[model samples]
Target: MTDFKYETVLSEIVEDGVRCITLNRPDRLNAMNRGLIDDVARAFEDANADQKTRAIIFTGAGKAFCAGDDRREHVHPTCEEEARDLVLAIQRSTYAIVLNHKPVVGAINGWAVGGGFEWAINCDFPIWGESARGFFPEVSLNLFVTGGVSSLLPVLVGLNTAREMLFLGERYDATQLQAMGVAWKTVSDPELMGTARSTARRLADLPPLSVRAMKRVLNATALTDLRRAMDLETEATIAGFMDPETTRRLKDF
Candidate 1:
């Protein structure tokens, strides 16, 4: 929690040792630009390594938790090689949270669409606003899943449910996800940050060693080699991006 400044993310460590990082592109609904994605991954890595950071909270500055990648960022990669590298890097952004030692909480204030949905679900626990909704629009957009979601999501909500999410690209509200056990809690829009902060504080107050150990054990059992899955997903995603129809579709969107 040293003095870190990022162009698209804001980080703050509370007195209680909870580090809150806000995705700062409100006008774009916190869309994942290349800069924002890298900033997010770096922020989580730094917070995890910091001894003073007991727990981390991730939220957006405005209405949406994230709206997935900016169209420009997606269109920027000039060739298959560059697109592959870019997709892998984007996939790693969400892994920065799941692979971290300490607990990560997502404060989902609004839309978490496409890659945004991947980001929220990868958090150790997510507290979402009543207005918050998430969806995997990848299939429709000719994109593949990232964030190790294909492997991790099946473990959370079962194979069929995960398929329904990915294949059908359905939008899920806070209540539906809470019912499916994907969301830890869902509160009113105004109460979202407060509830997440309170939960993060409770976690930060716990024994740091025990908390870290618990998260490690959980990852060992349930989140093993998440990076590998992300790599595979990245390959598929880049292929999709390179498809001419997908390029046309993205441009139209």
Candidate 2:
């Protein structure tokens, strides 16, 4: 893989040909600040272009996989222009991951809240740690989810279950997510990295062209509405950020 440097993310080649990109913000539980968001997007884009990178394993450096957006860094947008810009910037990470050529495996270690949870689902294969937890707190926070979740989620779990998850913003354990078909596997926290490495190794051993073709075909078939969902989410999220109530709520938090 190419030698890439990032402030909020760590990238390295591991497991023969797997690119391990770690979200690095231990003090903030790997929150998605603008720097982190941009770093993630760049890392995936670099991996996509690097012929040596056969697969990717995404994880967090600290306890939590990602705690959504960093309240301090992601200030509430004061105007429509700011909100639209922020929404587009935030969505870049999703586009990078979903559109990448190589397969991605999420090593979800801990909390995957809000946008963090959306990213986990965006992975081609998501392997959760036993203690991992996921939830959508966007509705409660006067915010909205992105990452094409509006379309991807309902397919993983039925519309009714998806409604419960999104509308209620309830937390679900790793086992629960696996049962819901959102997680490909749930392993003990100690085994999370090992499992991810093994999974990536298997993917790396496959014929690159065949694997890429299959991924493209699958995405084309199942995610026909992904772009539409992302557009709708961007609009909704920008509106949410522009609301004065959202600013007030964010301040209180």
Candidate 3:
């Protein structure tokens, strides 16, 4: 197979038609900075276009799957315009994952918070390690999750559980998430990637058109229509990020 044109993050095609995409900024705990955000979206888009790539497995390079938006990069210009642009970028990056047709799996090795949690939610399945943790702490930051979590969380763990997590900003360990039906499975930290890869390979072995059609059907149930849902999500995300309270909390972070 041809090599992937990767930069900012690392990506490679493994056996059994699995594409492994790793968030490479271990030094930052795999934080989603602006560059990594763009790269991740591009990686998924590329994988979607590649005929040989049947499934995608996403994971991080270090102690954490992703710590969320890098605090350093998020705290920018003390003005509204810059904040608007920042939010829009994040929304677009997130939309790429949600709209991708191929099966996507998240190998959560450690913490997945804020945007990181949203990223994981975008995946068709989330397989977590024993040490993995997931949380939506955006409420504490005066921000709401705009990364399709509002729609996805209820479906994963029920509306009551979703409200508790999003409204209270609580965090849950892999075991808890598994019990809540949010996680597909949990394995040892050392075996996280192996489990994810195996899952991806199994998925890739299935009939491609059937898999794609199933994904479309699943997504169809989530909204009045795909395009309408996307537009609503985009607008809500941009507005949430631009909220005065959210801006204040972001600056403080």
Q: Using Cα atoms with residue i matched to residue i, what is each candidate's TM-score against the true structure?
A: 0.94, 0.97, 0.90
**Tens digits of lDDT, candidate 3, 1-253:** 4366666677788886898888898989888888987788888888888898889898999899999878876655355576567666766755666776889988988889888888887888889999999888777876657666777788788989999999898889999989998888989998988899889999999999999988878887764354554456666656666677877777786
Q: Estimate candidate 3's alpha-carbon lDDT, on a 0 to 1 scale.
A: 0.80
Give per-residue CA lDDT, model 1, range 1-253, as digits (tens). 5356899999888656888989999999999888888898888888888888898888998889999878756555568998887776776677678876889989998899888888888888899899999998888878798988988888889989999999998888999999887898999998888888889999998998899899888887887767678778888888887788887777787
TM-score-better candidate, 2 vs 3 = 2
Among all windows of 10 consecutive residues in model 3, the one with the lowest summed lDDT is 222-231
Runs of candidate 1 with Cα error greater than 4 angstroms are none
lDDT of 2 by residue, 1-253 (tens): 4378999898999857888999999899998888888888888999899888999999998899999888878766668998888788878888889866799999998999887898899899999999999999888779888999999999889899999999999999999999999999999999999999999999999999999999889988988998999999999998888778887777776
- Total clashes, candidate 3? 0
Ranking by lDDT: 2, 1, 3
Q: Please provide the root mean square deviation of candidate 3 (C-alpha atoms, Å).
A: 2.2
Better of 1 and 2 by lDDT: 2
Task: Tell how far residue 62 is off in model 3, in angstroms.
Answer: 1.0
The backbone clash count of each candidate, in order, is 0, 0, 0
Q: Which pairs in model 3 have colliding backbones?
A: none
